[model samples]
Target chain A: DVKVTQSSRYLVKRTGEKVFLECVQDMDHENMFWYRQDPGLGLRLIYFSYDVKMKEKGDIPEGYSVSREKKERFSLILESASTNQTSMYLCASLNRDTTEAFFGQGTRLTVV
Target chain B: AQRVTQPEKLLSVFKGAPVELKCNYSYSGSPELFWYVQYSRQRLQLLLRHISRESIKGFTADLNKGETSFHLKKPFAQEEDSAMYYCALSGSGYGQNFVFGPGTRLSVLP
Candidate 1:
């Protein structure tokens, strides 16, 4: 079975503070993705990395950046956290050309 | 641009009753469709894909290109089958980003 693990299951940060969300996958998948889940908005992609050091902006990449220094780890960074940024974040990984993706439990971030 | 739409926000049914979750898509070219499920307190998981044409957990979905719809159906609902279902689609070209629907929460009553 494939395992995708997020660094934190829940987090709280003050406004204007910087935040980091880490994800690691044991499957060594080539594709890693960061998404935010909101009510009635579904899962909107924030950023994705296809390979080490290679990153692409998804539909909702504003105020967010990604790092993929290694194949097994992907990190999402928020430049300045705000109350509106509070939401559940999910990480996923998939094999090259495979449509099936495995997701982590998700981190619910609260910005006050 | 590729997009997926799941109209219903919630659906309720009794055990042994048939259930269908409607999903529609808007894509210019051929696209891959998938149904994902997230049970209570569990991480989201893929239920099935249109390309495979196989039934999983007694649930099946058929992609109709003309109608641009991929609706999931099950002959009988089980108590354990209650979960949040999401419809997703991937475009035929370029980046491999997938568009997902808002999702439908299904509740199966005993």
Candidate 2:
């Protein structure tokens, strides 16, 4: 089975602190994505990477950035955490040839 | 730009009843659509995709290109089917990012 692993399941950070959410995929999928899941708004894409060092901003990329220096790992960075930034972050990886996406367990972040 | 829309925010039905979750899309090119289900405390997973043309867990979706819709339907809903359902669209391009709908929460009452 394809596996996507997230670094943390829950986190609490002080406001203005820089935060990083890490994700790794064992399937060597070329496409990786970061999304923030909210109750009513659903999952809004934050950023995505298709190749090593290549990234694209999604619908909601205001306070977040992403890095994909290696093929197996993708990281999401919050420039300065804020209360409104607290959300459930999900990481997903997909094979370029297929549209099926494999997802990680998700990280629930709280900016206090 | 591609977008997916799920009209109903919540759907309620009794066990063994028929259920339909509406999904529509707005995209210029051919769209690849999928239905994803997240059960209670479970990671979101793919329930079905349009290309497969197969039913999963007795649920099926048909791509209506003329209407730009892919509605998920299941006859005789089960209690286990209650979950959060999301419809997604994949654009045609390099690095095709997926656009997901707001999602519908299905409640199956026994």
Candidate 3:
């Protein structure tokens, strides 16, 4: 089965602290994405990487950045964590040839 | 730019009833659409994609190009079908990023 592994299931961060959310996919997919899920806002894309060393900003990339130094791994970074950034973070990978996309078990982040 | 929209946020129905989840998209090029489901405590997974034209778990979606809509339907809903459903769309590009709808949570009452 296809697997997208997230580095953490739950995390708590302090204000102004730099944070990293890591994801690794075993499917050798070419596209990786980071999104934040909220109750009413749904899943808003934060960033996406099309290939190693190539990244694009999604609609909601104001407070977040991403890194994809390798094909199988993608990382989301919060330069300075804030209370509003606390939410469920999800990572997903897409097969370049198909329409199917696989998602990781989300990481619930809490910033105090 | 591509966007997916799910109109209903919540839907509750008794077992054995028919169910329909609406989805619409706005994109300039040909759209690749998919329906993803997330069960409680489970990771979000693809339930079906419009390109395959196949049904899974008795659920099927028909893509309407003129309407720019892809709606998921199940003739007889089951208790196990209750889950969060998301509609996603991809534009015409290699490794295109998907735009997802806000999702609809289905509740099947026993």
Q: State the lDDT of candidate 1 residue by residue for B1-110, as single tens digits.
A: 77888999999999999999999999987889999999999999999999999999999999999999999999999999999999998765445777789899999999
Rank all candidate structures by their TM-score, best first, as comma-separated numbers: 2, 3, 1
**Best candidate according to lDDT:** 2
Rank the models by DockQ, top first: 2, 3, 1
User: C-alpha displacement of B62 in model 3, angstroms?
Assistant: 0.3
Q: Which docking class does model 2 fall in?
A: high
Candidate achieving the largest DockQ: 2
Pull out the clashing pairs in model 3. Answer: none
Least accurate 10 contiguous residues by lDDT in model 3 chain B:
B89-98
TM-scores of chain A across the candidates, in order, are 0.96, 0.97, 0.97
For residues A1-112, what per-residue lDDT tens digits would candidate 3 score against the true structure? 6499999999999999999999999998889999999986789999999999999999899989999999999999999999999999999998887767889999999999
Number of the predicted model whose TM-score against the real structure is largest: 2
Candidate 3 residue-wise lDDT, B23-71, digit = tens: 9999998888999999999999999999899999999999999999999
Please give the interface root mean square deviation for model 2, in Å: 0.7
Per-candidate Cα lDDT values, in order, are 0.92, 0.94, 0.93
Off by over 4 Å in 1: none
Q: What is the lDDT of residue A33 in candidate 2?
A: 96
Q: Model 3: residues >4 Å from true position, as ranges?
A: none
